[model samples]
Every structure is written in C-alpha cells, then in structure tokens.
Target: MTSAAPTTHIVFPLYPGVTHLDFCGPHQVFARLPGVHLSVASEGGRDIEAEGLVFAGLEDLATITHCNVLCVPGGFGCVEAMERPGFMAAIRRLAGSADYVTSVCTGSLILAAAGLLEGRHAACHWAWRHMLTEFAAIPDEGRVVNDGNIWTGGGVTAGIDFALALVARIAGVGVAQTIQLALEYAPAPPFDSGRPDLAPETVVNGYREKLADVLRDREAAIRRVAAGRANRASQ
Candidate 1:
C-alpha cells in the first residue's frame, strides 16, 4: 500500500481592516485544493471587521509555530496594523518558519514591514508598488509575481489569480484548472478603468487627488515600520 502524502498546511493572518476580497479572493482558490488544511489567524483569535470597510470573516491568530504556506492581505487598515504592537513581530516569526510566504495587494508591504520580503522580488497594488523599495524589495508588474518561495499579487482581484498560480505550483496545472472551472472564475468587467492608464484622465486624476493624503500617510507608516525592523536587525 502506498503512503499518503502529508497534508499541505496553509494559514492566513487576519486582522481588523483587512480588505474582504483581498483575503477571500485567494482564499477561495486555496480552499479548493485537496489534502490541504487552512486557517485564518488574528490577534487573540478575535472577530475581525476589516475596519468596517468590508465584511471580512472573524478569525484569530493561529497558535501553530509554523505552516507550509503563510499569507497576508492588505487594506486601508494596514497603516494602523503597522503601528500595532507585536503584529509585525508575530508575522516575522511565522514567515521565518514558513515554507512559503505570500501576500496580496499592499499586503506585500506588510510582509516587507515584517522583513520577509527584503531582497525578494514581489508584487503589490499598482498604486503602492513603488513603496516596496522601502523594504529592499524589487517590484514587478502584472497580477502575480513568484520569486522563489515568496509569491505576491497585485491589487484586490489579483489574489484569485495568485492563489490559482500557487495551487498549480503546489499540486498541478490540472488540479488548479479544475478548481478554476469549478468556480467559474472567468471575469469580464464592464468598464476599462481598472488601471490608471486605461481609465479616463478625469477619473484617474480625481482618485489620485483624493488618495494623496492616504498615500502620504502610508509612506510615513512604512518608514516607521522599516525603522523598527532595522532596529531589531541590528540588535
């Protein structure tokens, strides 16, 4: 009799203010895989509300010391999360022991803050792609980027694509494709405004103007976290 393959263990750290789709999009793809165990982690295992922006599920931090794959998702609350005591440290601890470290959207920034993405090529939301450099990461374009055991996704919906790619890498193309087909993952948006280049100038400029303050704050937050990581490294 052949021995069964060891189950692939996956965990995603959940926190208040995590974007709903950022966590769920990729989550759905991974949940479809066979012989995979998944869980969501939050501080104290408390209910998470995504900072009231989206109705993400409730989860608490996993007590496990390590996992096969660990993921982090991003949202407006990331800035606050960066300022949260012991959060990045916990992430650093988990990523250090994980076989694979992954992130979605600005979540890569969080991973960077945790010192996981340093010296790694990764992907992030287009709006914040440049910020990856603060943590010594090389930025790439498109929906997904794979650099060794570190995988990252761009924006929100890209999580789905990233997870599918990760699944193919772990299992097989056939398995991932079957999951995609089962989910009917085909997407056809009515508008061509997903990216700034494709969107009308007015729409693009308006959003940029509106988000300038938020981006500035995010930059400041990154600097603070980067400093903290550097301090710990030198210690």
Candidate 2:
C-alpha cells in the first residue's frame, strides 16, 4: 500500500490593505493541491478590508514558527503594512523555516522589506517594480520567477502562474496540468494592454498619470520601510 501524502502547511500572510484577488486567485490553485493545509495568517489575526470585499479572519503569527510554504499577497495596503512595528521582523523569522518563500505582485515588496530578497531576483507589479532597489532586490521582468527557493509573481493575476509553477514543483506536472484544466485557466483578453511595452504609448502614459500619486506615496513608503529595517538591524 502507498503511504499517505505528506501534509504541507501553506500560509498566506494577511494585511488590511490587501488586494483580495491576489490572495484568492492563487489560493484556489494552491488549495486544490492534495494533502495541503492552507491557512491565512496575519500579524494580529484581524479581519482585512481588502480592495474587493472584507476578508473573514486570519490566525495570528505568534504560534507559527515555520511552514512548508509561505506566500505573501500584494495590494494597496502593503506600504502601510511595512510600516507596522515588528511586522517585517516577524516575517523574517517565519521565513527562516519556510521551504519556499513566495509573493504575488507588490507582495514581493513585503518580502523584500523583510530582507528575504536581498541580492535575489524577484518580480512585482510593473507600476512599482522599480522600487525594488530600495530593498536591494533585482527586479525581474517575467510573469513568474523562481530563483532558488524564492518565487515571485508579477502584478495581480500573475498569482495564478506562480501557483501553478509552485504546484508543479511541489507535486508534479500531471497534477499541475489537471488543476489548470479544472480551473479552465485560459486567457483571451479583449485588448492587448497587458504590459507597458505591449500597450499603446498613450495608454501607458494614462496609467502613469492616474497612478502618479500612488507611485510617489509607495516609493516613499518603501524607502521608509528600508530605513526602518536598517535601523532595527543596528540596534
């Protein structure tokens, strides 16, 4: 008889300003994996007001010393989340025992802030990927990047790609393919404005204009987080 599949503990770090889709899209794929114990953990186990709807609740991180996989989801709240005291330090500690440390979109920023991506390649939302230098992360241009045990996805929807790739690594190609098929993960968008280079110059410019304020604020936040980490390390 075959032995039971090893149970894998997967955790998604939660915050108030998350983008729910970034969390849920990859979650559906990860949850489908066999023998996977998926959980959402926050600094204080509080409910989050994400971009979409409200997240029900999450567990506190105090009891979790490690996990098989830890995925950090990104959204508008990441900047403020970085500012929270001991937040990045806690993530750094939890990541110490994580076999795979991953992120989706701006979630990579959080990982970088935690010092997980120092001198490592990572990807994030195009709008803010440039800010990775603040945390000493190499900005990767791919949809999903797997550098050593660190995996990062670009933008919001790219979480699906990251999840499938990780599933392939953890399980097998057959399992990943089956999950993809079950999810009917096909992309046939009506327009071709997915990336900045592919989109028309006018569209890119418009997006830049719309997000100008957010970009400025996010840049400052990243700098602040980096400085805070530096100061803590010195203490």
Candidate 3:
C-alpha cells in the first residue's frame, strides 16, 4: 500500500527585510510536524534577507497554489510589504483560502491591510496597536489572539506561542504540550517592558521613540488601505 501525502501546507511570505526570529521561531515549531510541507514565498523566486540573515530558495508569489496555514512575519521590511498592492493581494488570496491564517507582530498589519482583520479581534506588537484601529479591528495587545480560523501574536517572539496554539487546534492539546515541553517553553522575562501594561514610563517612552518613524509609515499605509477600500467601494 502506498502512503498518502499530507494535505497541510504552511506558507511563509518573505519580504526584503523580514525579521529572522519572526520567521524562524514559529517555523521551527511547524517544521517539527511530520508530513507538513513548508514553503517560503516571495514576490519573486529570489533570495531574501531577514535581519542580516539570508534565506535562499524562496518560491515566487505566483507559485502559491493553496495553503493549510499561512504565516506573515514582521520586520523593518513590513512597512513596504504591507503597503505593496501585489503583496497585499497575495496575502488576501492566501488568507481567504488558507485553513488558518496567522501573523506575528506587525505582520498583522499586513493582514489588516489586506482587509482580513475587519471586525476581528487580533493581536499585534503593543507598540503598533493604534494602527489596528484603521482596520476596524479590536486589537488585543495580548501574547496571542484566536479569532476562529485567524490567529495573531504580539511582537516577534510571540510567533512561538501562535504556532503552538495552531498545533493545539490541529493536532490536540497533548501534542501542543509535548512540543512546548520539548522546546522548554517557559517564560520569565527579566524585564517587564515586554507588554505595555507592565512597562515603566521610561521604557515605554523609549519604545515609543524607537517606533515613531515606523508609526509614521504605518499611518501612511493605513491611509492607503482606506483609500483603496474607498476606490473599490466606488467601483
């Protein structure tokens, strides 16, 4: 008897400047599953960089046929990627077809731009939640948010939790717990600034300073999305 191929497909969309951890953290967990096919997709089939790390052999966006799960990672490049018409269209296609669509940090912004977060409760990097208002999304600002088939995580490292939650949903709680234990997933951050509620004024202000420029760009992207939606409505 021949073995049947697994149907689950995990698609990772790569941009010019993705964060390594944003892709790798959840990727490591998903890759652990047997028979799960993982594909790194880009606007074209080319090499991409993530925080100075180069990833080779990514598929072009046109090559994406279907996916059981889709992951959009965040980084400095996201400012451009989230605004690209083709990129947002590709994400919208995947999110509309995928069994589960999820994102890490500002990756949620990309989904929001694709009009996927409308009326959805989602999570995003605490520093960037204000932008979610533009998408008509209720931002959780939590480590993870599960809104039916869509999942989102806060900041970079939270991708791990996002992936684990998917695992729990797909395989079972035992499988998810096993993977978590194997990864030794226990958290005790030395600093309290990981979340805004716990962050001190100085730390919060510092984070604000770091995000100011990105926030400006994000505002522009949100405006673009709004304009696009308006144009589509007029059509």
Worst 10 residues of 2 by lDDT: 55-64
For all candidates in order, the CA lDDT equals 0.86, 0.90, 0.85
Strongest candidate by lDDT: 2
- lDDT per residue (tens digit) for residues 1-235 in model 2: 9999899899898888889878898999999999999888887787778866777757886667779998999988898877776677677887899999999999999999888999999999999899998988999999999899999999999999999999999999999999999999998899998999999999999999999999898888788878977898899
1-235 per-residue lDDT for model 1 (tens digits): 9999789888888777789899888889999899988888788777788655533354556466778898899988887886776677678887887888999999998888777777899999888999999889998887899998899999999999999999999999999999999999999999989988899999999998999999998898888878877888899
Per-residue lDDT for 1-235 in model 3, tens only? 9889665789999898888898799998888765788998898877897776889878998679789999999887786887677887889888888999899988988888778888999888777777887778889867889998889989999999999988888888888888889889898888867777778988889988987887887688778877777689689
Q: Which segments of candidate 1 are over 4 A away from where they belong?
A: 51-59
TM-scores of all models? 0.93, 0.95, 0.93
Q: Once model 1 is optimally superposed onto the true structure by TM-score, how far is the C-alpha of residue 69 displaced, in angstroms?
A: 0.7
Screening candidate 1 with a backbone cut-off below 3 angstroms (N, C-alpha, C), the clashing residue pairs are 17-50, 17-51, 42-60, 42-61, 45-60
Candidate 2 TM-score versus the reference: 0.95
**How high a TM-score does candidate 1 get?**
0.93
Kindly report which residue stretches of model 3 are placed more than 4 angstroms away from their true locations once superposed. Answer: 2-5
